[model samples]
Target chain A: MRPLELRRIPLFATMTPADLAAVATVVEPVNYQRGTVLFGVGDPCAGISVVLDGIVRLFRRTPERREVTTGIVRAGGLMALCALCGEATHRDSAEALNHVHTVEIPTAALHVLGQRCPHLQEQAMRGLLERLDAVNAAFVIAQEQIPVQLLYLLRSVARLDQAAQRHPGDTMHPLALRLSHAELARLVGTDRATVTRALRLLEEQRLIQRKRGHVTGVVLSTPDRKVPV
Target chain B: MSDGGNRKVWYLRHIDLFASMTDEEVEEIAHLLDDHHIPPGVALLDHRDHDRVYLIKEGAVRLHTGGPEHQVTLALLPPGRMFGLSSTVGDADRTINATTLLPSYICFATWPKMAEVFARYPEVMFQLTRSLAEQVFRTETWLARLGMISPTARLADLLVELSDEFGEPSETGRRIRFRLTQADLARMIGVSRETVSRTMVELGRAGWVARESGRLVVRDRDALKMQANS
Candidate 1:
């Protein structure tokens, strides 16, 4: 909406005032409510969007048409940057986790402006590199055995919530998140029955305790183990 | 092209980051690349922006995590692909080890040197971005395939991907550049070695996969892809 607002985004933070203003002029503010699909796989990458508020989920469908959550982004995060900058089409679909606000910079304008601004193009390259590295880690967590898999996934989500820092010195982390078995299955790419089985196993080992059907907390048996990422 | 200098130019051109550059520009930049040969099974130390970016010029490298007792192969780096940026993954604060899968030739340049070239030929940023983005999509696709319901399906998915990424046309079918041991296949798919041996035997009987000059050849890629989805 405003050039100052655009400058607040780190991607534009290093740009000269002239370059920032040129980019700010192209950003179109868009908003969505919870449960709305923002974009689907194969959609032309319209442009890079910077999240102004709320959370968004990025996922890809399995061959069986099951949704497997890949990454989560909150306010102050950038979306579609890698696809818009690197690829022609969006590789994954995005959905609003809640009421969300995002501003998208039109591709044509960004391209025209990028030719004159090295900073914009450099930031996009750096962002793509970071995204690639982050997804690489997620793939590692996904391959861990089921019970350990769920624990890692929770910790991952908590990292987004900044909840992990709440117990910085403690072994146990209270997730305080309520998710249905089906949702849990989607996150881990397993069936609800398998999720139930894994949850039971985690409970028996005293690694996790559920409260009122919500995952209350988790305990890593060896918190100081050489983290294999 | 037989000379090291000319061969290096050819290899550098194959990399997407340098694909769109003029021959003269490529020749100029090729001189900036430092080359080295590594024996199979040797590990690469972590490389950062200052240390330099390395690309596989010949042979393959394996990226894996976990201790030696339980190593899981995450990816097999094909020629023209870069290495080292994957040194860290998220907040794990740990390093992913890369070991040479075969005797290899690697070419590298520090970020500062690469940036100088990028400044000189602005178009390279686009190519580099596309290269990085495609890598992200491939990694994501590999992640999804690992979630398939059956070990057979998982193995099929892996085979189809291997042929797509690192295989070449052969008399029998698509011959994978790397000779993967059944043990290597097992470690990659996170299944037991015996399971990989049995699955390979089955695929061989089905006429979908075969061995050629010690490399894997995918004879029926369409059928293999179908099985991967099934």
Candidate 2:
């Protein structure tokens, strides 16, 4: 394996060739087919994993047996940094949303890597802090009424996806692509019927265009209007 | 230690929120208490205003408000949870007025000191944020379950939650030693007291549950599980 390619990952992007080689020594590369279960709740997490390619969805099954998708881990982002410190248990399960490639580094190797590379240490610490902050923020936002929560989340994920564009007459940046009704509903914490009604309301105001797989564009429309459920 | 001092420590120990805090942190926080004791019937955190946040160290505190005809209990914060977070978040005022149910020893934390501690520890900040968020979600979830779900379904969901939190293994079933009064059940599920009474009676008759003096003996866990599924 060409260890030089390891430098392409965001976490190791700043490290030198020598540093990457040191990391490549302990990193075990693994690939999975779509729909694979990487781990489940209560399984011992030996260390952190970084997505080299493909998407992984992390979700928890509530006591009522409802499956709540907490987050999706995309390529270039690190997953499970808290496992390194052994502070959090595997409260959620990780499943491959698509055929995926990841590098699994044992906790011992991560500590040694951190000790060897100050850059990795700082990156890991900052990443963990930011992830915790995001999770806390998500918890707060999710508690709102489903419609309010969905609109807020759509704008957020749109911005995160880099499709956000400021419209002259509105406060929120309109997302350039239309999120499929089902995908939009899942993110918004509601059923498709509610999401469909919400989108239609927005469409009537010309705030957004609804198309297959994407919205044509977001436009300045009106003030924040509550979707009548 | 003085009688008052030892009682204060004993009270703080029972609060789950304080369990993770260090002794030094507790000692530092205790300095804010001022050895103040309020007699029963006094309002600690009045409805609709910013004031001191209190941690009960001795005696019971009933979080309630409204006039004689409209009064309701929000919570009976025994000794762990801090009350008056509305003030911290800039709520116009406390939504529920806390009254001394019995003579109580309470510790007060001024806003500045609270901010200082939050700034000093990221872990504390994370925990506090998550805890506050969870409290809001829990309250909302309870309200939604009561409003949108059937009483039997709500009771089933409550059983599932309690089983996860405090169930004990038994020969017949996983017994839940829940010590909630009928009034507490009404407040928790956001239903009328009478509805809670009727629901409990029906559940008992259905053989899904058996009620003792103040606890629920879940006899048919599988049946309740089916109800939750349905």
Best by DockQ: 1
**Model 2 lDDT tens row, B1-230:** 67866666666656554567777665655554555688877887744445456666666676654444445444455544466655211111214567775677877876566656554533444344334434433333443343334666767776766555446666545665435566655655545679878988887888877665546677787888778657
Candidate 1 lDDT over residue span B30-144, tens digit each:
8887988898888885645435677788889888777866666767887777777657665555467888878898877787877887787777766666667667777777677
Please tell me what DockQ candidate 1 reaches: 0.53
Off by more than 4 A, model 2:
A1-39, A46-58, A62-66, A70-88, A94-149, A159-172, A176-178, A188-198, A216-224, B13-29, B32-106, B111-154, B160-202, B207-230
How does residue A196 of candidate 2 score in lDDT? 77
- List candidate 1 segments past 4 Å from native: A76-78, A81-88, A162-178, A193-211, A216-222, A225-229, B1-3, B46-50, B91-93
Q: In angstroms, how far off is B60's CA in candidate 1?
A: 3.0
User: Tens-digit lDDT track for model 2 on A128-229?
Assistant: 434433443344344345654555455544443423324344544545334577866654446888877777766675555656645545543234554443
* lDDT, residue A47, model 2: 79
Q: In candidate 1, residue A199 scores what lDDT?
A: 83
